[model samples]
Target: MPELLNSRVETCFQQAEAFFNRPFKRAQVSLKLRGQKAGVAHLHENLLRFNPQLYRENREDFLKQTVAHEVAHLVAHQLFGDSIAPHGEEWQLIMRGVYELPPLRCHNYAVKRRSVTRYIYRCPCDGSDFAFSAQRHGLVHQGRRYLCRRCRHTLVFSGETRVE
Candidate 1:
Protein backbone atom coordinates (compact mmCIF):
# COMPACT_ATOMS: atom_id res chain seq x y z
CA MET A 1 0.00 0.00 0.00
CA PRO A 2 2.83 2.39 0.85
CA GLU A 3 4.52 1.61 -2.44
CA LEU A 4 1.27 2.22 -4.30
CA LEU A 5 0.79 5.53 -2.46
CA ASN A 6 4.37 6.53 -3.28
CA SER A 7 3.75 5.73 -6.93
CA ARG A 8 0.53 7.76 -6.93
CA VAL A 9 2.33 10.72 -5.34
CA GLU A 10 5.23 10.53 -7.79
CA THR A 11 2.78 10.32 -10.66
CA CYS A 12 1.10 13.52 -9.48
CA PHE A 13 4.46 15.28 -9.27
CA GLN A 14 5.24 14.13 -12.78
CA GLN A 15 1.87 15.39 -13.96
CA ALA A 16 2.47 18.75 -12.27
CA GLU A 17 5.92 19.07 -13.85
CA ALA A 18 4.51 18.37 -17.29
CA PHE A 19 1.61 20.77 -16.78
CA PHE A 20 3.75 23.65 -15.48
CA ASN A 21 6.81 22.81 -17.54
CA ARG A 22 9.08 22.71 -14.48
CA PRO A 23 10.59 20.13 -12.16
CA PHE A 24 9.10 19.55 -8.71
CA LYS A 25 10.86 17.81 -5.86
CA ARG A 26 9.43 14.44 -4.88
CA ALA A 27 7.53 14.73 -1.60
CA GLN A 28 8.29 12.46 1.38
CA VAL A 29 5.33 10.24 2.20
CA SER A 30 4.19 8.92 5.61
CA LEU A 31 1.18 7.02 6.89
CA LYS A 32 1.32 8.52 10.39
CA LEU A 33 -1.78 10.68 10.22
CA ARG A 34 -4.72 9.94 12.56
CA GLY A 35 -8.18 11.28 13.44
CA GLN A 36 -10.69 12.85 11.04
CA LYS A 37 -8.33 14.19 8.37
CA ALA A 38 -7.72 12.02 5.32
CA GLY A 39 -4.32 13.53 4.65
CA VAL A 40 -2.16 16.59 5.22
CA ALA A 41 0.75 18.19 3.37
CA HIS A 42 3.64 19.71 5.24
CA LEU A 43 4.74 22.20 2.62
CA HIS A 44 7.97 23.33 4.26
CA GLU A 45 9.16 19.76 4.79
CA ASN A 46 7.80 18.56 1.43
CA LEU A 47 5.97 15.80 3.31
CA LEU A 48 2.67 14.02 2.75
CA ARG A 49 0.92 12.31 5.69
CA PHE A 50 -1.96 9.94 5.15
CA ASN A 51 -4.37 8.40 7.64
CA PRO A 52 -3.65 4.70 7.32
CA GLN A 53 -6.92 3.64 8.91
CA LEU A 54 -8.90 5.87 6.57
CA TYR A 55 -6.92 4.62 3.59
CA ARG A 56 -7.72 1.01 4.50
CA GLU A 57 -11.43 1.90 4.64
CA ASN A 58 -11.55 4.06 1.51
CA ARG A 59 -8.76 2.74 -0.67
CA GLU A 60 -9.92 4.06 -4.04
CA ASP A 61 -10.71 7.60 -2.85
CA PHE A 62 -7.42 7.78 -0.98
CA LEU A 63 -5.45 6.80 -4.08
CA LYS A 64 -7.36 9.19 -6.36
CA GLN A 65 -8.30 12.33 -4.41
CA THR A 66 -6.22 12.22 -1.24
CA VAL A 67 -2.93 11.65 -3.03
CA ALA A 68 -3.63 14.45 -5.52
CA HIS A 69 -4.75 16.81 -2.80
CA GLU A 70 -1.58 16.44 -0.72
CA VAL A 71 0.65 16.58 -3.80
CA ALA A 72 -1.10 19.74 -4.98
CA HIS A 73 -0.18 21.38 -1.66
CA LEU A 74 3.51 20.59 -2.12
CA VAL A 75 3.38 21.64 -5.78
CA ALA A 76 1.61 24.91 -5.01
CA HIS A 77 4.02 25.72 -2.20
CA GLN A 78 7.05 25.00 -4.40
CA LEU A 79 5.60 27.24 -7.12
CA PHE A 80 4.01 30.11 -5.17
CA GLY A 81 5.95 30.09 -1.88
CA ASP A 82 4.44 30.07 1.63
CA SER A 83 2.49 33.33 1.38
CA ILE A 84 -0.39 31.70 -0.54
CA ALA A 85 -3.24 30.08 1.34
CA PRO A 86 -3.08 26.31 1.88
CA HIS A 87 -6.12 25.78 -0.36
CA GLY A 88 -5.96 29.04 -2.23
CA GLU A 89 -6.09 29.78 -5.94
CA GLU A 90 -2.64 28.32 -6.61
CA TRP A 91 -3.52 24.97 -5.02
CA GLN A 92 -6.88 24.95 -6.77
CA LEU A 93 -5.17 25.62 -10.11
CA ILE A 94 -2.79 22.71 -9.53
CA MET A 95 -5.71 20.44 -8.62
CA ARG A 96 -7.84 21.45 -11.59
CA GLY A 97 -5.39 22.36 -14.34
CA VAL A 98 -2.52 20.08 -13.46
CA TYR A 99 -4.04 17.01 -11.87
CA GLU A 100 -7.44 17.39 -13.54
CA LEU A 101 -9.20 16.71 -10.24
CA PRO A 102 -11.79 18.69 -8.29
CA PRO A 103 -10.35 21.02 -5.66
CA LEU A 104 -12.14 19.42 -2.75
CA ARG A 105 -11.13 20.83 0.64
CA CYS A 106 -12.29 17.82 2.66
CA HIS A 107 -13.05 14.13 2.24
CA ASN A 108 -16.35 12.42 3.01
CA TYR A 109 -15.02 9.04 4.14
CA ALA A 110 -16.67 7.48 7.18
CA VAL A 111 -14.39 8.13 10.15
CA LYS A 112 -14.06 5.85 13.13
CA ARG A 113 -15.48 7.38 16.27
CA ARG A 114 -12.84 7.61 18.95
CA SER A 115 -13.20 7.76 22.70
CA VAL A 116 -13.10 11.45 23.55
CA THR A 117 -14.24 13.93 26.17
CA ARG A 118 -16.32 16.71 24.61
CA TYR A 119 -16.92 20.15 26.09
CA ILE A 120 -20.44 21.31 25.49
CA TYR A 121 -21.28 24.63 23.83
CA ARG A 122 -24.54 26.25 22.81
CA CYS A 123 -25.67 28.61 20.07
CA PRO A 124 -28.22 31.28 20.97
CA CYS A 125 -30.29 30.86 17.83
CA ASP A 126 -32.68 27.99 18.54
CA GLY A 127 -30.46 27.16 21.52
CA SER A 128 -28.73 24.43 19.61
CA ASP A 129 -25.75 22.68 21.18
CA PHE A 130 -22.31 21.65 19.96
CA ALA A 131 -19.66 19.28 21.24
CA PHE A 132 -16.13 20.63 21.13
CA SER A 133 -12.97 18.61 21.62
CA ALA A 134 -10.51 19.51 24.38
CA GLN A 135 -8.15 21.07 21.85
CA ARG A 136 -10.80 23.39 20.44
CA HIS A 137 -12.19 24.12 23.89
CA GLY A 138 -8.72 25.15 24.98
CA LEU A 139 -8.50 27.38 21.93
CA VAL A 140 -11.71 29.07 23.05
CA HIS A 141 -10.02 29.84 26.38
CA GLN A 142 -7.20 31.41 24.34
CA GLY A 143 -9.84 33.71 22.76
CA ARG A 144 -10.86 31.68 19.75
CA ARG A 145 -14.52 32.26 19.05
CA TYR A 146 -16.45 29.38 17.51
CA LEU A 147 -19.60 29.86 15.44
CA CYS A 148 -22.48 27.50 14.89
CA ARG A 149 -22.72 26.51 11.25
CA ARG A 150 -26.46 26.13 11.24
CA CYS A 151 -27.40 29.39 13.02
CA ARG A 152 -24.29 31.42 12.31
CA HIS A 153 -24.17 32.51 15.95
CA THR A 154 -21.37 32.49 18.49
CA LEU A 155 -21.16 29.28 20.54
CA VAL A 156 -21.07 29.83 24.26
CA PHE A 157 -19.79 27.24 26.68
CA SER A 158 -22.63 25.51 28.41
CA GLY A 159 -20.31 24.53 31.27
CA GLU A 160 -20.82 20.84 30.57
CA THR A 161 -18.73 17.95 29.35
CA ARG A 162 -19.35 14.49 27.89
CA VAL A 163 -17.15 11.40 27.68
CA GLU A 164 -17.74 9.17 24.69
Candidate 2:
Protein backbone atom coordinates (compact mmCIF):
# COMPACT_ATOMS: atom_id res chain seq x y z
CA MET A 1 0.00 0.00 0.00
CA PRO A 2 2.83 2.39 0.86
CA GLU A 3 4.63 1.62 -2.39
CA LEU A 4 1.47 2.14 -4.38
CA LEU A 5 0.85 5.50 -2.72
CA ASN A 6 4.41 6.58 -3.36
CA SER A 7 4.15 5.50 -7.00
CA ARG A 8 0.98 7.48 -7.57
CA VAL A 9 2.51 10.54 -5.91
CA GLU A 10 5.72 10.17 -7.89
CA THR A 11 3.79 9.92 -11.13
CA CYS A 12 2.10 13.21 -10.37
CA PHE A 13 5.46 14.82 -9.59
CA GLN A 14 6.99 13.53 -12.81
CA GLN A 15 4.12 14.90 -14.84
CA ALA A 16 4.50 18.24 -13.14
CA GLU A 17 8.24 18.26 -13.75
CA ALA A 18 7.75 17.59 -17.42
CA PHE A 19 4.97 20.10 -17.84
CA PHE A 20 6.65 22.89 -15.94
CA ASN A 21 10.10 22.09 -17.31
CA ARG A 22 11.47 22.07 -13.78
CA PRO A 23 12.78 19.26 -11.66
CA PHE A 24 11.33 18.07 -8.36
CA LYS A 25 14.04 15.74 -7.22
CA ARG A 26 12.95 12.60 -5.46
CA ALA A 27 15.34 13.14 -2.56
CA GLN A 28 14.11 16.65 -1.82
CA VAL A 29 10.63 15.45 -0.82
CA SER A 30 9.72 13.65 2.38
CA LEU A 31 6.34 12.01 1.92
CA LYS A 32 4.60 10.56 4.94
CA LEU A 33 1.15 9.19 5.65
CA ARG A 34 0.67 10.46 9.17
CA GLY A 35 -1.32 13.60 9.92
CA GLN A 36 -4.82 14.71 10.87
CA LYS A 37 -5.20 16.50 7.58
CA ALA A 38 -6.14 14.38 4.59
CA GLY A 39 -3.25 15.82 2.61
CA VAL A 40 -0.97 18.79 3.12
CA ALA A 41 1.84 20.31 1.13
CA HIS A 42 4.57 22.12 3.02
CA LEU A 43 6.09 24.13 0.27
CA HIS A 44 8.98 25.49 2.29
CA GLU A 45 10.10 22.09 3.54
CA ASN A 46 9.01 20.10 0.50
CA LEU A 47 7.00 17.70 2.57
CA LEU A 48 3.80 15.92 1.57
CA ARG A 49 1.74 14.61 4.47
CA PHE A 50 -1.32 12.38 4.09
CA ASN A 51 -3.48 10.49 6.52
CA PRO A 52 -2.86 6.75 6.12
CA GLN A 53 -6.10 5.80 7.86
CA LEU A 54 -8.09 7.83 5.40
CA TYR A 55 -6.11 6.36 2.50
CA ARG A 56 -6.64 2.76 3.58
CA GLU A 57 -10.36 3.22 4.13
CA ASN A 58 -10.88 5.14 0.92
CA ARG A 59 -8.19 3.66 -1.30
CA GLU A 60 -9.77 4.21 -4.68
CA ASP A 61 -10.86 7.76 -4.09
CA PHE A 62 -7.69 8.61 -2.17
CA LEU A 63 -5.45 7.53 -4.99
CA LYS A 64 -7.56 9.06 -7.74
CA GLN A 65 -8.76 12.27 -6.11
CA THR A 66 -6.88 13.03 -2.92
CA VAL A 67 -3.55 12.17 -4.45
CA ALA A 68 -4.22 14.56 -7.29
CA HIS A 69 -5.40 17.26 -4.93
CA GLU A 70 -2.29 17.21 -2.73
CA VAL A 71 0.12 16.88 -5.63
CA ALA A 72 -1.60 19.78 -7.36
CA HIS A 73 -0.73 22.01 -4.43
CA LEU A 74 2.94 21.19 -4.74
CA VAL A 75 2.85 21.71 -8.49
CA ALA A 76 1.04 24.99 -8.11
CA HIS A 77 3.50 26.21 -5.50
CA GLN A 78 6.50 25.23 -7.57
CA LEU A 79 5.13 26.72 -10.77
CA PHE A 80 3.42 29.82 -9.44
CA GLY A 81 5.03 30.31 -6.01
CA ASP A 82 3.41 30.68 -2.58
CA SER A 83 2.13 34.20 -3.27
CA ILE A 84 -0.75 32.68 -5.23
CA ALA A 85 -3.79 31.68 -3.22
CA PRO A 86 -3.57 28.14 -1.90
CA HIS A 87 -6.60 26.97 -3.88
CA GLY A 88 -6.90 29.75 -6.37
CA GLU A 89 -6.66 29.88 -10.16
CA GLU A 90 -3.11 28.52 -10.27
CA TRP A 91 -4.06 25.39 -8.35
CA GLN A 92 -7.29 24.97 -10.30
CA LEU A 93 -5.38 25.03 -13.56
CA ILE A 94 -3.06 22.30 -12.35
CA MET A 95 -6.01 20.20 -11.21
CA ARG A 96 -7.79 20.53 -14.54
CA GLY A 97 -4.94 20.61 -17.03
CA VAL A 98 -2.43 18.37 -15.33
CA TYR A 99 -4.32 15.93 -13.16
CA GLU A 100 -7.65 16.07 -14.99
CA LEU A 101 -9.48 16.39 -11.69
CA PRO A 102 -11.97 18.83 -10.23
CA PRO A 103 -10.60 21.81 -8.35
CA LEU A 104 -12.48 21.10 -5.18
CA ARG A 105 -11.20 22.94 -2.10
CA CYS A 106 -12.30 20.38 0.47
CA HIS A 107 -12.94 16.64 0.76
CA ASN A 108 -15.88 14.75 2.27
CA TYR A 109 -14.61 11.78 4.24
CA ALA A 110 -16.41 10.13 7.11
CA VAL A 111 -13.50 10.29 9.50
CA LYS A 112 -14.73 9.46 12.96
CA ARG A 113 -14.00 12.07 15.57
CA ARG A 114 -13.26 10.88 19.04
CA SER A 115 -14.72 12.86 21.92
CA VAL A 116 -11.68 14.37 23.54
CA THR A 117 -11.30 17.52 25.59
CA ARG A 118 -11.54 20.53 23.32
CA TYR A 119 -9.40 23.42 24.47
CA ILE A 120 -10.54 26.85 23.51
CA TYR A 121 -7.88 28.81 21.66
CA ARG A 122 -7.86 32.14 19.95
CA CYS A 123 -5.57 34.26 17.88
CA PRO A 124 -5.89 38.01 17.54
CA CYS A 125 -7.15 37.56 13.99
CA ASP A 126 -9.70 34.92 15.01
CA GLY A 127 -10.92 36.72 18.16
CA SER A 128 -12.18 33.94 20.45
CA ASP A 129 -13.20 31.85 17.49
CA PHE A 130 -11.69 28.41 17.62
CA ALA A 131 -10.96 25.22 19.51
CA PHE A 132 -8.10 22.86 18.95
CA SER A 133 -8.54 19.23 17.96
CA ALA A 134 -7.50 16.65 20.55
CA GLN A 135 -4.41 15.83 18.57
CA ARG A 136 -3.52 19.46 18.13
CA HIS A 137 -4.28 20.26 21.74
CA GLY A 138 -2.00 17.45 22.78
CA LEU A 139 0.71 18.88 20.64
CA VAL A 140 0.26 22.23 22.30
CA HIS A 141 0.50 20.58 25.70
CA GLN A 142 3.80 19.11 24.55
CA GLY A 143 5.09 22.64 23.87
CA ARG A 144 4.50 22.67 20.17
CA ARG A 145 3.34 26.08 19.08
CA TYR A 146 0.91 26.83 16.30
CA LEU A 147 0.31 30.08 14.51
CA CYS A 148 -2.91 31.20 12.94
CA ARG A 149 -2.94 30.64 9.21
CA ARG A 150 -4.92 33.81 8.57
CA CYS A 151 -3.21 36.53 10.55
CA ARG A 152 -0.04 34.66 11.44
CA HIS A 153 -0.56 35.36 15.14
CA THR A 154 0.19 32.85 17.84
CA LEU A 155 -2.83 31.09 19.34
CA VAL A 156 -3.56 31.50 23.04
CA PHE A 157 -5.55 29.03 25.03
CA SER A 158 -8.67 30.50 26.60
CA GLY A 159 -9.49 27.72 29.07
CA GLU A 160 -7.81 26.91 32.35
CA THR A 161 -4.53 25.04 32.01
CA ARG A 162 -4.40 21.50 33.29
CA VAL A 163 -1.36 19.28 33.44
CA GLU A 164 -1.97 15.90 31.91
The estimated TM-scores of all candidates read: 0.71, 0.65
Instruction: For residues 79-132, write the lDDT of model 2, one tens digit per residue.
Output: 778799999999999889888889988878778664456677888874855667
Question: Residue 162 deviation, candidate 1, in Å?
Answer: 9.4
Per-residue alpha-carbon lDDT of model 1 for 1-164, expressed as tens digits?
Answer: 46888889989999999998999998778899999999999988888899999998998988999999999999999998989998899999989998889999999999979899999999998878789999999999999998889877889999999999
Candidate 2 collision pairs: none
List the lowest-lDDT window of 10 residues for candidate 1.
1-10
Query: How does each model score on lDDT?
Result: 0.91, 0.78
Clashing pairs in 1: none
Q: What is candidate 2's CA lDDT for residue 146?
A: 87
